[model samples]
Target: MANFTLKVTRLGFCLLQSLSPRIAGKVAFRLFCVTPSSKPKGEKAKRAHAAGVAKLADAERFRLRLSGGGLAHAYRLNGGALGRRGRYLVTHGWGSSSAYMADLATTLAATGAEVIAVDFPGHGCAAGRALHMGMAVKAIAAAEARFGAFDAAIGHSFGGAALIVAAAGLLPGVPAVLPQKLVLIGSPSEMHWLFKGFGKLIGLGWPAQQVFENEVRRVTGRRVEEFDASRTAGAIQRPVLIVHAEDDKEVSADHARRYAAAGDEVRLHWANGFGHRRIVAAQPVLDTITSFLGEVISDKDAEIIPLFDLPARRMSL
Candidate 1:
């Protein structure tokens, strides 16, 4: 009877999820837990595997040394050409470096868009001890000084949240650098829920979730509720493309829906079975981004830089 009752409860929860995805997402985020791997021996191998997977393109790489900030960062720029009107600045997620977005950058470049991919502080070759949204925004500003204003900004996971914070001017004196179009991939709308889910993944109990929230509040000096993308969506007047995978076990797809619900300018694209990381590399995802940027270029305000014109490697197929 106990097992049967559990099964019935699960079925009911599933039915509720079908009926109300947002509420169901909150529930699932609270309940679902992940356990860390016990095999310490595989850590090095895992890092090596991750590095291998990150190797995507052979684009020209350059370093940007920020003046006065005492910081130096690496960036990968592809499809350099004269009279290019627009740029695509890509920010990678937590635990990922600029190399992770190589394929997407390559695809965007191939579609006649100059792509600027940067490594956030404390990641990749960037010289920093810790990563913060302020530093990331500074990096963007520095990049803008060198590469000029971007036509569109695409961020993945944590980078997506940082993108919002950057555009909202949450960091004082940091001017809101608004892009004509914003693309958020696998970004959660609520930081509290996301941190709670992260706690569960690391075996943190309910108490830990509360502590995590408190810490976040103390650090940011703002209530977690204030960061809801749904509430702040109206502040962003530019068109937004929110992409998420239906099978994503990291960040729920409902977060995308919340972003879409926040404003009519937002469009939601739901992909299936690509999981979180693979969704970024998917061809369909690339095609959609290319099409969006192409439209922006057609507006006559933006310039397009074709990859074939670059003096780099020649395309042989």
Candidate 2:
């Protein structure tokens, strides 16, 4: 049924393209921005989602009203240790909620770091049907205003892209909420690649794609290709730790390579077999992130901290 629906949807777009490319492009772009449902499907899936939510039961839940008239739900976990390090922000990917990030948030919170995880407009408990980077940025800005600047931010996939863009202060009117450090796991380097991928998914050819790009520019006030997180990372002087699995099929490892070449302070960690989503909860990835955040290097003590037994390599450039 899902396959049939998808085929029918594709055929509808094809017919629309034949009739009016402009209208087809507009509809395609709107459909492209539609947020996926975060609700659990079956009984087993419901149990798993309930478990994820249960993990955040101890957290102080709150909501921030976004400038775009949407509300972002957030969960704040206070540090367990007496010597609190600092506040940290954790943002999940598209089609994900703050509950999904509970593992990482709880881990960070356990080690004396106050962690806040947020659900962007349409995801999790936040109410909305559509989401874009602009809305994501506004959500982050609202969080900053409510809780103040975060010392570090860890983002997975789309959340990472939004984090980089918000930190870079690329979009006008929205003030930058740059953290002291960053962790981008399985993130895309630019927006055009995503747009191109979406084009392929919807069977949109060059004419429709051109119209889509024009619509993108109208919405973002910038060319689709201009939203490069790698370029933004280089421009904004901050230490960034990029964790990417060599086996990440959803997002190419080439994106991580692009980020590694972007700046001297950027460090890339290669994880094996974890793919995109699992890498978020993988022990080695978590260790690497925490070490990156906690490590203090003096001239005499400059050496790589020994992490987990996982086959991982770190590149400092």
Candidate 3:
């Protein structure tokens, strides 16, 4: 069934690509922007979501609505402490349910900090056919309003890009939702990388690609180039911890390096074997990230520098 679905989807894309770039671009924008729900990923993923929620102490679950009938499934775990212990928001990658990130969210909940997680539109129980950066940014703001400001925001893949956008004041509300501490795992530095790769995979020409990006600009009010994390990373003074496995197959590990290069105290955690998705659920990765989160929360004087692991055979740049 999965193979058949893949083949059919491919055939549909081929047919779409055969059309003029303008028409194809508009069609592609709608198809790609729409998110399929999180129902398809199977039992293990479902169990993970349940387990993550079970792990949360005093979990508060709710639904949030956005423009165009988009919805977000949100979860909140209050800080173990009585008073204000700070709140942390967790957002997962594209095509990923918030359940996929429940592990980290629950783990953060173990600390005294309030932990929050949300399934973006078209992910998990959120009702939408697709998701785009603009919607993701809106979701972040919505989460902020419901839970108050975030002390830190942890995002994986697309979530990281949204965080950068929120921090950079690139969204609708100037100063959208800013987290004092930021964590980005396996994040893409630029949308050009994603669009270019998708274009090649589907045999989309430059004209189609440009048209698609133009459509994105028209819908989101932001150009593709503006999504680059490195472009605005330098100005964000908040301490950042970027973890990317050397073997990450999706977003390049260099994204971590580039983010660090953009400056403002980025600590890169270079894992050796864990790929993009696994990096998020890895125990060591979680420990490293939570440690950084704690440091920023507890130590006013904490400082950091660039970090990465190079192949033993290759000389460091």
Candidate 4:
């Protein structure tokens, strides 16, 4: 039924494109920006959600008002009288909440580093139902204001693009701080690819596609292609670790190559078999990220010590 409904919707968009390209593009653009709800429904799901929250009950929960006027939810871990090595800011991808990133954030906190995982606009516990890269940048700036400068920022998928854009400090009035290092897991390198792909998915014609692109430019004050992470790689000039699986069905591994090619310090880790979502929580990937961030686990911290071997090797693009 869902597949059939999607096909009918695509057909409707195609007809609308024929009648009025501008209107069709506007509607499609709005649909494209809408994020799926992360709130759990039903008794079993709610119970699972509660369990996940309880796992991080020790975290210091907080919120920040973003420039977009929405409350950005975030939580701080390992912040109470612990010897800190560094501070890390973490962000989740589209259709996901900070709960999904709790594993990585908790592990980082276990290393005695202060870790704060942010729920971006329209995601997790944050307010709103729509999100764009611009809004995401504001969320990062808001978190930085509340938490101060971070030693590193880690993002998965959509979150990765937000981190790179915020680090670039290209957007006006955002005043985002660039982190010392970055880790991008299963992230896209270009907004152009995502926009064009969405257009094709909804059966938008050339005229409709142009209108959609114009809407993006008007909202962001830049072309969709300009949102490329590879371009930001040159501007930030910071150490970057790109963990991508070759078998990823969502964002292609080529996106990882784009960043590696553009930056001298970018290292690409081919974490095969984990696909897109699981790659974010895989033990090997987590270990590689910790090593990149200069984290050294002591004998006393058995919980933070990694059990998986680091998987780092060169792959032919």
Score each candidate by Cα lDDT. Answer: 0.65, 0.83, 0.76, 0.82
Best by TM-score, which number? 2
User: What is candidate 4's lDDT per residue for 1-317, written digit by digit as tens?
Assistant: 27898899899998898899999999988999898877876787576567657767888889889874767899999775764347799998888878878778888877667898999878778888988888888889999998787878999999998999899886777886788789999999988888888899888999999999888777766777778888787668787889999999999999998988976878899999999888877899999988888642223432332322111111111
Instruction: lDDT winner between 3 and 4, please give it.
Output: 4
lDDT of 3 by residue, 4-36 (tens): 775676576667767677777677677667665
Sequence-dependent TM-score of model 3: 0.84
Candidate 3: segments with Cα more than 4 A from true spot = 1-19, 40-47, 56-58, 67-69, 79-82, 173-175, 297-317
> Sorted on TM-score, highest at the top, how do the candidates line up?
2, 4, 3, 1
- What RMSD does each model have against the real structure? 10.5, 6.3, 8.2, 7.6
Of candidate 2, the 10-residue stretch with the lowest lDDT total is: 308-317
Residue-level lDDT of model 2, residues 34-120, one tens digit each, is 998889777975775687799998788888898858888888887444333467899989888887777788888876677889899
Q: Give the TM-scores of the predictions, in the order they appear.
A: 0.69, 0.88, 0.84, 0.87
Q: lDDT, candidate 4, residue 135?
A: 81
